[model samples]
Target: MFSLKKSQMFALIISSLIVGYTTTMINAKADSGYTVVKRMTGNNANVAYHLANNSKNTYLWNGIHTKAKANLRKYKNYSWRYYGKSLILSHNSKKSLYYYIQGITPNGNEASKIRGIVWHSYLTPGINPNYKQLNNIYYRYFNTDSEYLHYVQKSPSQKLTREVLKLFPNTHLSIQLTKAADGASPWAWASPRVDGYKNILEFPTVQKYFNKRFYKPNISDNTRFKLIKAGLDKSYSQTKRNALTQYQIGIYYYNNPHRLIDDEAPGFTIAIPE
Candidate 1:
């Protein structure tokens, strides 16, 4: 629901262009024989080399948090959501062999952490798949400490698009832009109208509770409430408010935007995609 001002949008566009240009330069300078796979397509020399070198290695299966595992198993049994064969699940440390061999990290210590799983053509096609399963599992399994769960090595933006296409071809993907300074936590406080308790609310609940409480005239609390209501009403129409609420729910349920843990630690469910 946080919007970027004109200046901020301009800056971000410029920065993205710079990054794209830099990536092109880096690829050009690489060794002559190297086949540079576009990072956005998840086809890179590094990913190809890893797959080729580690074809024989065994991958460990690290099941999602208890809840997510149950859900996945149930889905596997009942729903025909997954296509192709499921790859062996493994703990990140065990998977370190592939990354280490690829020279992604210098040592096991550096490699042993939560990372997106890269999928092969058999499981997924087009670009390198940076698996979000781990992040989802961590949020579900360890709900309270989900905020502390940090993912390492995000897939590049271009590769991310290809990965999405591999999973859901012909889908129209919409990016809902929000301000960078909105903080990772989606829920924030509106200044309190009540004297003692803080008027804390999640984005979805904001509209439902808007302007419901009446503060006494001449009190500063009343003035603050008016200001807040004006801001919310002015910035977001009812339809836009609904959309933003849905977006927040997506963040909470799937992406774990604030990384809140649910009943099961490291559990995951398909978030309702925007």
Candidate 2:
């Protein structure tokens, strides 16, 4: 074997380091998988995931692309590297249920189809025990067309929250705050329309109402509840949902009561004891 020059050796070392870093990141994401399925299906409410054509040997790249027609000799026909294996797609029908994938490459490029839908079996189930699952059957149907990815963002929900509050001026926000102060999870507080039930149980109707009010799919019931839950417990334990352990949620509610309704802002306000 011949020896390399100093400059060549340095370049080789840098290339190895770069490749190692990239591999580590990809392995971390792939091995752990993602909790793309948010388990908070409300009765008759729309969920994030829907059944689409099954993916067979489909590759999910760090970007999006369909099978682009190109000269195989001139360009690389497929992605050089992909994070997930056997990526699938959901049908574009308005009536079908779809899955919500977090932390994906945004703004689909021309190279590939949006990789929103993955193999249902590939995902880990029962990650969220507090919420119920939605009805969806997984089947591998080949998609004939390019796919598009869509999701609910915060501004739209905030607009809906503002609109609903405008229609129903009187809500149990104050009472809910009091309950939170008295050692109740904000999600644990129930309303009169619902029989002493709070949180995920109470959110479906609200989700349905907002879905109609907003004239589009709002966030999932579980996701919406968790948003509120997360806002309350933002700075505290990343795991536990209790108010005592994470006083930040109490503070968030006390100061920014509107945040609970507005799905975007996070503050420690409502229930913190002075």
Candidate 3:
């Protein structure tokens, strides 16, 4: 039998309530696993993903990270309608929520229509509006790094809205450039990454740019294209290049606001939509 004083009993009850609340939150976030999914507009994309990898391929799979069914790059600019969502367990037992979607065209070529699964991130409408290459920023990379562009941005404020940021990958950003001169102010750098794209695609008002390798704007304006910064283009050491080339998509992200491997990497901000 268990017994407790009045104060002790009150404390015990408080602890139990806290634990229950935490468990509810945790359970709410747990993956809901199912194969078939319902169709939804929110999961849809107004434009197709850019296949910016050296391979120039954006693959859709038979299932979550499963067999490749088709390449969306062939149908560039096409819109996608989302079917639903499903949590899939990879070989490592990691859960990746994938969108089951199909490409649409005005022609409606049923036979040529592409249908498959892809990460929701891949279906972003397009690059962030704020991401653009600066004329004076330093270009950081080798000829081998053509798959993705890298650069450094120096600014007193890291409050990013529609502003473009150039983050580097594989190498340490500090070695390539000097730190804040007088005192530390927010700065950011962009480079390719080995993991899934770290840029929070859903981040409100954050800007992005199209990787020239896989992106061609619907319009003929060359100004929309992202260009390499004006200085420095040295090849990385063999080890660094190997790691940076892990994914064909070339996940480029930032090197500041250090915390979890998140959009906070360099200059991504949490701004309210106007």
Candidate 2 global CA lDDT score: 0.27
Where does candidate 1 stray beyond 4 Å?
A: 1-97, 100-187, 191-250, 254-274
What shift in Å separates residue 159 of candidate 2 from its native position after superposition? 28
lDDT of 3 at 136: 17
Ranking of all candidate structures by their lDDT, best first: 3, 2, 1
| Candidate 2: Cα lDDT at 11 | 93
What is the C-alpha lDDT profile of model 2 across 95-127, one tens digit per residue?
222232321111111223344333343333211
Candidate with the larger TM-score of 2 and 3 = 3
**What overall lDDT goes with each candidate model?**
0.25, 0.27, 0.35
Candidate 3 structure quality by residue, lDDT tens digits, 136-219: 111122112321132223221221211232222332222112211101112332422222224212221122322222233242
lDDT (Cα) of model 3: 0.35
- Candidate 2's C-alpha runs over 4 A off are 1-4, 15-100, 103-115, 126-193, 196-259, 262-274
The stretch of ten residues in a row with the least summed lDDT in candidate 1 is: 72-81
Q: Per model, how many backbone clashes are there?
A: 21, 29, 12
Which structure is stronger by lDDT: 2 or 3?
A: 3
